[model samples]
Target: MTTGVTGRLGGIARHARPRGPIETLAEVSVSVESGLASDFRGAVKPGGRGRRQVSLIEAGDWAAAMAETGHSLPWWHRRANLLVEGLDLPKTPGTRLRIGQVVLEITQECDPCSRMEEVAEGLKAALTPDWRGGALARVIAGGVIAVGDTIEIIEG
Candidate 1:
């Protein structure tokens, strides 16, 4: 139950294919059936359980991790789908967040992988604690979303 708090969608990015370069976007369409447009992970599974459809990171958390690792890098290097600011993302699953017309359900923590180290030495370790790596979410309601969109907890 998040109350009296709101966040902003600071940025949006999606990779065309697995391990592909992340493309920064000003706006994009999202769908429960396809997740984010042009994203490699957009396709829904057979059971419609696409928990990792959208990966979100807190801007402050990203900054904290970078400060810890002492490696200055863009947030895209983390390869997250969305950068949310002005609100602290909850660690608990089932927390619902809304960005523009889209509603996302937090499914789990998006664990950091070796790719982070490839992007920056020590990055993986820096993002390891306290859900710094961000959260994995499934799109429950889909629509157009854009940079500067409001991100708010829709349900506890």
Candidate 2:
């Protein structure tokens, strides 16, 4: 049997282009073709185009990284599409998750990119260990997802 984990979607963020400033959102529309409405990466990249159609992070992990780095930047600075709390994001690929009306399949680890260094020195390294950086996923069944939406593993 596939084990499951439960959590809540804590935050959402998007931007128009690479390295662009993130815009926080209370709700977002998702689709197989467009992962998150209006988000540059989502609109531009179609499903199966890449494993990183959407990205997610754990709120507690972000906090831990902040405490370790001694910097208090906003969660959007992490550049993930979703921030979740209450469950540890599975590190293995192929994990399936349900967030509100949407279902997503974990494709790979959303490894810390060099851009993290620009946000704050040592931020990249701080997020490098323990799956603190979260995971990249692709939308399987899409719909509207809102802040405070329940998150749970459908399969893992």
Cα-based lDDT at residue 27, candidate 2: 98
Output the number of the lDDT-best candidate: 1
Per-residue CA lDDT of model 1 for 40-127, tens digit only, reads 8978879778988999999998999999989889998899999999998989899998888899999999999998988988999999
For candidate 1, give the lDDT of residue 93. Answer: 94
Q: Which segments of candidate 1 are over 4 A away from where they belong?
A: none
Q: In order, what lDDT does every prediction score?
A: 0.91, 0.89
lDDT of 2 at 71: 100
| Clash count, one per candidate | 0, 0
RMSD of 1: 1.0
Residues 1-156, candidate 2, lDDT per residue (tens digit)? 256678999999999789887899999999988789978777434234557789999999999999999999988899999999998888888889999899998988888989899899999999999889989998889999999999999997
Q: List the candidates' TM-scores in order.
A: 0.96, 0.94
Worst 10 residues of 2 by lDDT: 41-50
